[model samples]
Target: MSKKGPRLGEPASLVRMRVVPIASVMFASALPLMLPMIANSPALPPLGLLFFLCWQLLRSEMWPVWIGLPLGLWDDMFSGMPFGTAAGLWTLASIAIDYSSQRIYWRGFFHDWAIAAFLVAIIQSLAALIAHPHAPMGRVLGLIVPQIVISALLVPLFMRLTGKFDNFRLKRR
Candidate 1:
């Protein structure tokens, strides 16, 4: 017989199957803080948001609707936004994706990319508004252009990584 899964009676641990996705998401949330690079613009790419969206899209229904709450709270600890901003925005995005996924089916790579770009823009816009309530809407959105572009472009990379992590997470140990 060909070798594929765990041999004969070797069973996979539930925790073993789970650690990859959870760890990858946690690592993504913490990465920006750990990096030493400083940018001229205050905007840094939103890696935590990017990773969360990718995973949710690739594995729809894998997480509950409130998953974003704790993850966003975790992100809040590292992300320097005024508290509860990421939490609200993340939960909103999660809700939006849940509703949209029910209406759409047969997503190809480009479709996923488009959906991600739209959500990223929406998330960044709302975040900008929340963070800069007094600023003119135009300026607030303008300031976030670099952040939106960077986050949007990185969608494919995050999506690819999500798929790999997803596949590995289910592979037989």
Candidate 2:
């Protein structure tokens, strides 16, 4: 045999152990909802949800349709948006992504961004509704709109980072 250790375009024969993408996404989704020591204000935009959407949109194959259930459960535990709110929304988002992917023959970064913005806004709105069901419309809008805008603005940055992480995850050993 030749001295070449491995050939280009070859798959790894040995199974490479890597962190579960869903687990990381779920953890990221929980971070922004956590309470801080100072207790001054609500947590920053939901980084975890932003990260989740980035992962789903950028690397759809890595996540299954049912992935949302467990992840949503985890988010519910931390987000305080009622037990089933995140669960249902996240699962629905996953299904929506699946449907969109199937229907759209072509996609680009901007399209993905638009879809992400819409989804983030919707999810944030739902979370606020669940948290303050009896609150005035203006109050709810006041609560979640900023967070949605922040989340939408941060999507590109999160997508870039997730791309890097995905490259690492898929790299040949």
Model 2 alpha-carbon drift over 4 Å, by segment: 1-18, 33-41
Q: Which ten residues in a row have the lowest lDDT in candidate 1?
A: 9-18
lDDT of each: 0.84, 0.77
lDDT of 1 by residue, 1-173 (tens): 78766777675667856677667877888998898988755567888889899988888788887888888888888877778888888898889888888988778888889989999999888877887899998888778888899889999999998988877777667
Q: In candidate 1, which residue pairs clash?
A: none
Q: How much is 105 displaced in model 1, in angstroms?
A: 2.4
Q: How many residue pairs clash in each candidate?
A: 0, 2
| Model 1 stretches astray by more than 4 angstroms | 1-5, 8-12
What is the Cα-based lDDT of residue 149 in candidate 2? 84
What TM-score against the true fold does each predicted structure earn?
A: 0.89, 0.86
